[model samples]
Target: MAQVDRQQWDVVVVGAGGAGLRAAIEARERGARTAVVCKSLFGKAHTVMAEGGIAASMGNVNGHDNWQVHFRDTMRGGKFLGQWRMAELHAREAPDRVWELETWGALFDRTPDGRISQRNFGGHEYPRLAHVGDRTGLELIRTLQQKATALQQEDFAAYGDHEARLKVFQECTVTRVLKDGGRVAGAFCYERESGRFFVLEAPAVVLATGGIGKSFKTTSNSWEYTGDGHALALLAGAPLLNMEFVQFHPTGMVWPPSVKGILVTESVRGDGGVLRNSDGRRFMFDYVPDVFKDKYAQTEDEADRWYEDPDGNRRPPELLPRDEVARAINAEVKAGRGSPHGGVFLDVSTRMSPERVKRRLPSMYHQFKELADVDITAEPMEVGPTCHYVMGGVAVDSETAAAEGVPGLFAAGEVAGGMHGSNRLGGNSLSDLLVFGRRAGLHAAALAAAPGPRPRVSPEQVDAAAAEALAPFHAREGAENPYTLHQELQSAMNDLVGIIRREDEMAEALRRLASLRERAARAGVEGHRQFNPGWHLALDLRNMLLVSECVARAALERTESRGGHTREDCPAMERAWRPVNLLCRPVEPPPADPAADRIRLERVRTEPIRPDLLALFEKEELVKYLAEEELPE
Candidate 1:
């Protein structure tokens, strides 16, 4: 075997997005040496794709807004299937996290009163999203990255080495999380620039590698979201929670084919945009479900008045939770009321003046004009549902962010499960990243500082990882092409286990996935490892296939529809299924049969909501989602 580079750190954060950067900062501040590994260039992680804003209960725009209201709204948005403790923690801490960012030099757009400005988003009770125009995520990354740099500068003054306390290993991908006995030891990684292998030896490894959207054909996610963290956790024996729930955002680019799945930020509707069908009808009003009828306005007059007097009028139907809105858009298109590109019209041109549109949504304006040649100020954009987020992820402790069943391993951001439950609200994602990212970092640092011997990284595991990564280069003639295998996997996942799912389709998806798994084993590349994207993709196929199978299997196991997992055969949300979380665990050892299942699905009951948290919602509202036993007697 060739010699491999080796480095030692107290904490290894396997990503550099909002969560990863935040975690690294916390770990370094607590006096632990940290290393941040990312697949893209530093500061270019998928968090930059988040455009709407960060959801926090700062109450700058609405005095009625608070952590309690935010908590209730989050539970309702997830249809009460979320981890109650995680949601509570997120709502309670999000405000402090946002304020902390400001102290770290984040400059947010402000209200006339000079407070951080907040904006409306789907499923929120008030204007709770703190933002800087439509590019809040970019601003967030800028602030956090600068903060990390400042920490390095301070370390340089103290230790005479900038990277003595914290360092970033950019453009690197982790193939495996190496373990000693039952605890996390480190990670096996390869640099994308040179394809050189190395080991980052650490007691604590934080997985913040974001979502699994790239497995589907039409997704707002970038190439990096191949379920890397989720698969790594599963392979290391941590179960994935609620893998069936996947969020398809209500609005994504639908025209010109080239940019079909690019995100159309939810800020448009939050700022008075409406969803209209071909007949120019405000179709959302007619599609509001019984559960949300009282909350959303029925008449256009009431809906329009909500902008000026939110206290006196119900919110517009367009502002319903993303799941409802996405399903509505899907229904409209299926009913033949779709736009020329097989989507519905999202019009802000008629509602807001051109100046306001440009001032508020500069990114959306440029995105459409540059990508699809559409002028949004004068015309409505053709938009439809796109696979945006996966609520299922590595199951972790709500308080510590430590991955269950894996000592010294932690997870946060989109990679950690139980925070958002089945469906996440539009702006909650950024806040979730901040709140839990900090917790994960704090606990991981503490674990690293514990009095004990460090876990050992086994040479056998490193050799196996290297051999697996190199297998694609040694394939025989007539081997399956990695690109074709990827496309087939995407098509299968998108067509069968997409927004709307059924038992038969999902079962067939499992069948197709089995065959793909067999062929993916023989997936080959035509080039050497150095700067070889083909080789990288062939390696990524393993994670993609694993996560996709988890989705199909869990989607099939759960019979009822709720949040992102909608079943046509079982359309109604069953109260019985609300408290039962489906956990996906990898099948132990190796199976000889090619068609054998790789992941075993287990149903675990969720913790009962605390008494005080239960008191936040009215009994009548709770009756809609909770089972008879779950509600207070």
Candidate 2:
């Protein structure tokens, strides 16, 4: 391996998604020279594809809604397993962040009174989502991109304000995080377009690389969400918490192979969509328990009445939390009420006017028209669950977004754990990116400002990372195809550990993952580094393997169902199970480079809940909120 060109930055953020961009902006504002690195174009990051609105306590739709209620709802939603501090911070700061975005030129939809509009979503006590129809993510990305560009121009005019200008490294893939002694020093990356290696030296590094949804065969996540940050943190000995709690969005398009698993935004439900099977029966009514039974109208007449009167007696069908709705859909399919396409119908045309649908869901309308050739305003959308967000990630303090036990490294957004706990509420993820991403940035920038002696990146460490990166290219005798292995991994995860899980199947999934890991060692690559899908897949496979293993292991350790990690074998929530979190750390290789042992698992202590909040967990208030909320549609 040749010596790569080296550049020093005060802060290096690996990812240009919502979290990364926010972090870069905050760091620049805090007087740190920041660089944003990503594997794709800046605006093309997966954040652009987010369809739902952002969650914030703007109190625009309801005066009763406030941060305290939001905080309480979030805690309950996560089954009391979420870090209370992070949840508190998210609720407190989210409203301000949303307003900040508006100041930055984001044009959110307005309510009847002209305040930022709020909509109902799963697990919220009141309507709190601020949105722009359904294409909230696209609007957000475009606004941030424009802001970044403007900041760049302003910095150029000032010339000496190096901190104001952010250096963006596009098409750069980080292979490994380089540590000096015990702390993170820098990172090793390869430029995809030029096929040249670059060593980025920074005192502070932020990993915002997003979720591990691609580990499943069917997912709503984009190709870039391969869990790179999760793998990188794990390899660097950071503890990953709650790996078992993966969220499955209930309404992914199931028909038409070309558009398979595309997300059907929850806002459709929030706007009055009814989920029905071929039998035309509302199944959630039967599945809902006493907890949610009263909150929603029991009959179709009541549902319609609720729609007619916004503050009426019935809860809309669209307001059901994702888990409850997903389970309901699964039950319908199992009961042989599925449509010909193996999905249930999400019908909104009956409640919403065609013009209203088009105005509110332009992107959704366009997507269905171009991809599935269906007019959503006239027809029912066929939908089912698809792997979406991971609610669990690296354990971090809520205030700082700093990974516990790791110094000089920070995490934010989906990569950092403890905000959502067992499940994430709709519209909360974008807000999380803004609030926590900025916190991580401010903290990292502060550290970077007080300059100490620069840490050294050893030649040996660079060689090892380069060898691992180039192994697939040099393996001429290997028969294992990286793409096939990835497919197999995805299939196994989808079958065994997805939606509802069982012990026997989860064990089998683990066995399959171990086999895939062996094959990944000999995975082959045929094309050059530039624009090579095969090579990119090969590299991404490693991250997928680490994430899959962690998730499988964490699922196995938890013997009770809570939040997203549902186990058919253990059908009930166990209060005793709340004490410990399943923490995973990479096993150190033995001296003389012996084969690495299985990753070690340790049980970390979850902060004890206050006595006052115990009833929320014991009584399962969050679960009730999910089961009963009146969705808008």
Against the true structure, whose TM-score is highest?
Answer: 1
lDDT of 1 by residue, 380-489 (tens): 98899999999999999999999999999999999998988889998999999999999999999999999989998877888898998899999888789889999999
Tens digit per residue, CA lDDT, model 2, 374-428: 8899999889989999998988877888877777689998998889988888888
Residues forming the 10-long window of minimal summed lDDT in candidate 1: 304-313
lDDT of each: 0.92, 0.83
* Deviating ranges (above 4 Å) for candidate 1: 593-595
For model 2, the superposed segments whose C-alpha errors exceed 4 Å read 160-164, 312-314, 590-597, 610-633
lDDT of 2 at 538: 89
Local distance difference test, candidate 1: 0.92
Instruction: TM-score each candidate.
Output: 0.99, 0.94
Angstrom error of the Cα, residue 280, model 1: value is 1.1
